[model samples]
Target: MASKERKTPLIRVKNLYKVFGPNAGKVLQQVKEGKSKDDILAETGHTVGLSDINMDIYPGEIFVVMGLSGSGKSTLIRHFNRLIDPTAGVIEVEGSDVMSFDDKALQQFRRHKMSMVFQRFGLMPHRSVLDNIGYGLQIQGVAKQEREKLARYWLETVGLDGYDKHFPANLSGGQQQRVGLARALCTDADILLMDEAFSALDPLIRSEMQDQLIELQEKLHKTIVFITHDLDEALRLGDRIAILRDGVLVQQGEPVDILLHPADDYVEAFVKDVNRARALTVETVMKPQVCRISAETIGEALAEMRKSKDDYGYYINEDGYQGVITQETLEGVEQSEYDKAIDPSLLDSVPAVHTDALLEAVIPETLDSEHPLPVINADGDVEGRLSRSTLAEVLSDQAGSEEDDEKVKKLKTSKSLAA
Candidate 1:
């Protein structure tokens, strides 16, 4: 989801390269000169973990890094808190160079600025859930009573309140994972680095955890860097996705941009089977196709609406959510309501959907409201109007396509049997 605001990046990486072997620094220049990972490994026995990687991660957004195993996604995330130092490059957080931190600065940074949730739910089997959650704060020298109180708040926040006395061994996998999540939150860090955090959960549990992350993000708005090999998970959680292949960044952009316009065959194939209705944002299905017009340009906006044959449009201005206008309201009960902003007196306000919100969210908003929904961006400025008919068409078409694909597969199997 693209926000219109020009907020400064919380983290920035420039010309980042990582080499796994002992001769990493020597081979780093070869990588920068466009050498392949395989070539670098074959010649000098140096494994290229990342090559010329540059990215900007904004505050209060989930930035997902994904690739198949060996793509170096995990390696890239490690360098954020200097878990794995880069062979060469600049790593900056809030304008401070991460690579320059001394041991004490690094330890404090890891304790107060960043926390990681591991794939295997790294928990202390001997420690109770409450103690485990408070482990981070305890390390920071917080008093036992105060740390427990904060831990208890996060435990309840993650819906594990009554299980405080339980040990990691006594809980199910999902419960243990939730405890890990609670522990991370209890630290109250500014950034969270989750490396395949929910990859080990069963499908239902995975979905539940994903929902928890999304719901929590709505209120917490912490800057999160998530890693996964699963494309579906990437689509569901990423505010912007960066894809890697063989230690190189193949593509990086908003999920909708990745879906509607892949940068290459690799990205295209990755998204080929995705369910658009589920992954698509409200902006894609919003009326008139084009979006983000000004309130003063009601004439052009109205013309575009008529061209697309939609009844409603939003009169968006810099201040945001000005009003919604209908065709009848715009026609003005007279000659063409010529080139001017629609009368604010004739407009009505309705519930708004952020342009980055999934189309699935639009259905409920539409059901609860009588008028077409207003679509907005991060700054709460009106971006477009999402119509009920448009959302239905998107969902219906996807469902129909899947049904047809299943029927065709069945028919092919029947023919094989007859032969």
Candidate 2:
């Protein structure tokens, strides 16, 4: 018989609980025995830091925990590397239960398998930038010369080249954050826990740091759990966002899906002000259909568009489909005394996007460009035209569909009970 395959999560938290109070231990004992939330609350009068939290973080995924203050986002992330002990739960990393590890084992796990960056730049005040970055390696007993070399490499990675001799006090907020990031990454830790690493920076520096994180993630692909209170920051950087409210996981998914179809009123309120049109893209809205164009008269082009019931007409060329002329283009057209500069290359103005790109990623270019963008296949062939209204309608319909589904589910449950 083939052995049963066990799919191990990179990081797993099962029935995690953390309570803060004099009777916290007793309350957590009740929680472990599967007591009701109210019973556990009443028994210990303990504040639940994290309540029965369950999550599986995949390898190489940027998993973000988002919540307001005191929502347990930081508490949950800390439980992963055992920076803070959970009152009740099994925390697993690489198929090993970290919560079960002895002090020596836990220390080795943190030193080798994980690294953390905090909101405050935790660099040593007396140490040089290089020493601060390599501090983790030094703790692990790496040779001084080797640790220095690794620190230099990390400084370059974080775009802090030629600042190896400077102390933490000499750096700006952004530079300090970069040093913090470099220090965390210098360990080459398989798992990274970042607790609001950019929260202390100015708005401009925060945005810049976010961009740097994106760039670094692309290159390193380390499994990361980032905690942040800013939804926009979560949306900008997370591969998947886990939203928390009052120590409960409200919802979790990709940014576009969450924005377009929130799970409840809480989520909707969070996303209400977002520009759906700008957040969604041509690829998200475009229908997959055979789009054809004629190499004949403008009348033939118009006829083809009318026949296809398409808003735009694709212009075919010997090389391939060259450009698209929409009704808007034709409406904007004017006759000129001088022969219009009809560069055949005008067709290239149409922006093309891959199917995998999030609608939000494609919107800014389309909205800012002179011409409408075409949805393209992997081969760069025109798939469909994406207009502003089309993208807007898609978002509206998606939101409506989610609401409709919820109503349908409720009705079914009510009917079942009535019967």
Task: Report the number of the highest-lDDT candidate.
Answer: 1
Each prediction's total of clashing residue pairs, residues at least 3 apart in sequence or on different chains, is 0, 3
Give the Cα-based TM-score of candidate 1 against the true structure.
0.76
Residue 237 of model 1 has an lDDT of 91
Cα lDDT of model 1 overall? 0.82
lDDT of 1 by residue, 325-404 (tens): 67666555344556666567867767788876776555665644656677777777665666555554454423234234
- Assess the local accuracy of residue 176 in candidate 2 as a C-alpha lDDT between 0 and 100: 93
lDDT of 2 by residue, 1-419 (tens): 00123346788889888888887877777666666555666766777788778888887778889988988899888888877888877988888989779999988999999999999988899999999999999999999999999999999988999999999999998999899999999999999899999999999999999888888887887888999998788777777789887677889877767877789998888888765544443554676533466445444454466676666656765565667666544434443411343345334456566654666566555444544566776676777765444443454434334234443334334322223
lDDT of residue 131 for candidate 1: 98
Error of 2 at 140 (Å): 1.6
Q: Model 1, poorest ten-residue lDDT window?
A: 410-419
